[model samples]
Target: MKKFLVLGILFALPITAYLFFASGKNNFARLPVLTEKVKDIDQFKTNTDSVISFRDKISVVAFFGSELDDIKGNTFNLDQKILEKYYDFNDFQFVLVLPEEAETRTQQFVTEFNKISESSKWKIAYASPQKVQEVFDSFQSPHKLDENSFTPYVFIIDKDLQLRGRDDDEDDGKLYGYDSSNVAELSNKMNDDVKVILAEYRLALKRNNREK
Candidate 1:
C-alpha cells in the first residue's frame, strides 16, 4: 500500500504540472495573415525619412484615424501600457498609422509620447486615406474600424507582416473578438499575445539555425 501511494503521488504531480502549463499555452490565438508584408514603407509617411519595415521585427499596427477624438487618448493609453511592459525588448515594435491629414497631430503625438521616455520603441506616422482604406479592406475584417467611427481595434502583425487576432482559426477576419474597453484586461491580453508570437518566432529562428 505504501509503494502504491508513493507511485500515485509521483504520477499526479507531473500531470498537475502539465495541466498548468497547457492551460497557459492558449493565451494568444493564431489569427489569419492580414498582409504578407508592408511593401511601401514610404506610403507610411513620417516626419523623418527614416525607413521602417515589418521585415525584421514583430509589429503591432493600429489605425488612429483623426487624433482629435477620444479614441486617440485611449489608443495612446494602451500603447503606453504596452511600452511600459515591453520597452526593453528590441525585437518588437508598435506603429500607429494616422490619416495624411493628421500629419501635424501625428508629430505632436509622437513628441509627447517620446517625452515620457528618452527612448520609444513605438512610432507614429500618417498615410493617405486611400492607402489606409486599402489596408482595412485587405484585412476584410470589420473590426478594423469601429462600426460607428473611424477608430480601429489594435492588430498584431508578425515579423512576416501577417496580421493576427485572438481567434483559434481564421473567421474571414470576423474574429471580431475581444474588448479593449477595459484597459487592464486589454493590456494583459495584448502583452501576452505579443509574447506568444515573439516566442514562436524565436523558436523558429533557433530551429533554422540548428538546421543550417
Candidate 2:
C-alpha cells in the first residue's frame, strides 16, 4: 500500500506543475508594451486649437487621406464598431491625424464624426507635411507614401505615449496581431487588445501601491 501511494504522488506532482506553468505562460504572453517610445508630438495641434497630448490616456492614432474613397471605409469602422464599443471608457481618445491638405475640410470632418459619437474624446488634428512624415517614419510603417497614396493603418499608443506593437524579444512579449484586410475582424481584434492593455495598466498601478 505504501509503495502504491508513493507512485501516485510522484505522477501527480509533475502533472500539476506542468499545468501551473502552462497557465502562467499564456497569461504572460497575452499583451506586450511598445518597446520604443514615440517621438514627442506636442508640436502637433488639434482642431480645437489645443496642443495634442495623451499624457495619461490611451490614444488610437490613424493617418487619414483627403480622398473620399480612401477615407470612407475606415470612418465607418471607427464610428460604427470601435466608438460604439468603447464609448464609456473616458480615458481613451481617438486622434485622426489628417494630412495638411485636409485642413480645408476640418469642419466637415468634425461634423461627420460627431454625428456618430458626440463625445469630446474624438479629435481631428493636423501637422506640417514634413512633421507628419517624421512621425510616421518613427512607427516603421509598412506601406510607402507616394504623391497620392498612403496606408490606412491605425497605431495604438499607450498612456505614456508609447506606440504598441510586437516586441522582437524571444521571451514572452508577443502581441496580438490582426488582419487589416477585413475591417470587422480588425475592429474586434483591436477592441480586445485595447481592453487587455488597459487591464494591464490597472494591474501595474495596484502593484505599485502595494509596494509603497
Consecutive 10-residue window with the lowest summed lDDT within model 1: 169-178
Please give, for residues 1-212, the per-residue lDDT of candidate 2 as tens digits.
Answer: 99999999999999999987755332455456553666656777777877877567777776665553556666667656666666567677777766667777767656776676653566766677677777767666454444432446677778776777555423334432333445765555566566666677778889999999
* Candidate-wise lDDT, in order: 0.62, 0.64
Among all candidates shown, the one with the greatest TM-score: 1
Query: What are the C-alpha RMSDs, in order, of all predicted structures?
Result: 4.0, 5.3
Total residue pair clashes for candidate 1: 1
lDDT tens digits, residue span 146-183, model 1 = 43225546767676656665554333323332344557
Q: Which runs in model 1 stand beyond 4 Å of their true positions?
A: 1-23, 27-42, 117-119, 144-149, 169-180
lDDT of 2: 0.64
Q: How accurate is candidate 1 locally (lDDT)?
A: 0.62
